[model samples]
Target: MPDTTRARIQQEAARLFVKSGYHGVSMREVAEAVGVTKPALYHHYADKEALFLAMLEGTLAGLSRLVQAANSQVGIRLQLDTLVYELLASAPEQRVGLQLASELRHVSPERRAAFEQEYRRVWVGGLSRLFEDAAARGELRGDLPPAMLARAFLAITYPLVTGAPTSDPQGTARALLAVFLDGATPRQGAA
Candidate 1:
């Protein structure tokens, strides 16, 4: 079907873009990777920029939905667990997003700015709200600003979702959350 071909083109383009940076990969390469002709690819997306932007948008939208779902959960632990698991479950796509994100400098300034703003609004803003609620309930460690806490959480989890070598995503997510919530030092209790 046409829809299936379009989706395949998107997926292949994302993988190629991640593997060979945006500037390095050609539209022909993407078409070949997708087993489509250049004209067919153009029919799906006007240009490489259009295709790349579409890929980025899809990745961000998926992540936003995941974070929103996690946010609906009651407890901080459950929220973090669900967020991490869902993110890692889509690690391949997330890596493509991460790759494109790092290469945003190559995109037009206006487009880059818009993408950055939406990304922050979705990921950072969502996390900040969650952290704020947790802090209010004494669920967080210290009095750090919710925005800062959100950024820290993102930094901690970035590599995990991107390309970090992790044999066990679920276990890694749990350990990372524990270290995030409890800090490096153990609590005053039986070992």
Candidate 2:
């Protein structure tokens, strides 16, 4: 199959899944959304569960690669800022990703643990390593464990990307980073 057709199906499915819960949407709806026949959708994905799993995995794997790439560059603050901004910009994908976390029960029990592990490995695991690296370099606050700090950082930023509205993504990123790094107080020598 061609890349565009497959990509369109995935994109449309992600949209539908995000808008409607896992069980709410059907393969027929996905096919109609993608302007393809039901059989064509099946050619791309065995079933709705398979399609959802693929979307979730793709999102996590993409995030892992993104963070790893960002970590290689200098300036941890800039890295975090860039990451937050990018995540907010990709609202659809982020929504789909978060929705998958809540709706994983729809996944088969046999595959559930493996899928969750994959999600952790790509998303949490990658970010945890980045935080660990920052801690080793004395770039992160030493009060909290690097793992805890990473989780906190994600918790703080997750809402911003998942569903929060932002007129200014950069400003929002700056505020979030400041809060995550420095708490709510104004830094010394600031107005």
Candidate 3:
């Protein structure tokens, strides 16, 4: 049989996890929300923590794909502008996993470690590559670290959970790009 049940489980479970903190929801509730028996949910995920980890992994993978697409752009400015706009334009529910950023403590150390590794490798590493490539081309300041620049770039997007999805992603993209690039660009006659 197909694993459509797994997909259904993830959708319902993500809603539940986003609605309630990691500790606030239970396996039974997830099963109930998905209209499946506890056994069916368990067959897909070992436990609540496992389900949460899966959600986090999916979120990272989605973001990694976004960054990968942005890399095809010729310039760091275009790559970052496009990435930010795409993220801001995304459905709020699509970011539900990351929106639960504060609840990661409820997850076990081992699982958290694994997710952190993947997060750094795919998400942060992907953004860092954009800056790294730009720095190699002398398009950005070599005096600063690309990872630091990448983190600064990402910090702007963290507040996304509180606001409505952008009605004008392009204008927002332009405004955001101007702010970021203004700081990131090198100074010609600095003492």
Can you give the TM-score per candidate against the true fold? 0.89, 0.88, 0.90
- In the range 36-67, model 1's lDDT, one tens digit per residue, is 88998899889988888888888789888988
Candidate 2, overall lDDT? 0.81
RMSD of 3: 3.3
Quote the positional error of residue 5 for candidate 1 in Å: 2.1
Residue 60 of model 2, lDDT score: 81
Better of 1 and 2 by TM-score: 1
Q: Could you tell which candidate, 2 or 3, scores higher by TM-score? A: 3
Alpha carbon lDDT at 114, candidate 2 = 91
Candidate 2 TM-score, C-alpha based = 0.88
Query: Clashes in model 2: which pairs?
Result: none
**Any idea how many clashes model 2 has?**
0
Comparison by lDDT, 1 against 3, better one:
1
The top-ranked prediction according to TM-score is 3
Question: What's model 1's TM-score?
Answer: 0.89
Clashing pairs in 3: none
Looking at model 1, which ten-residue stretch has the lowest summed lDDT?
A: 134-143
How high is the lDDT of residue 190 in model 2?
92
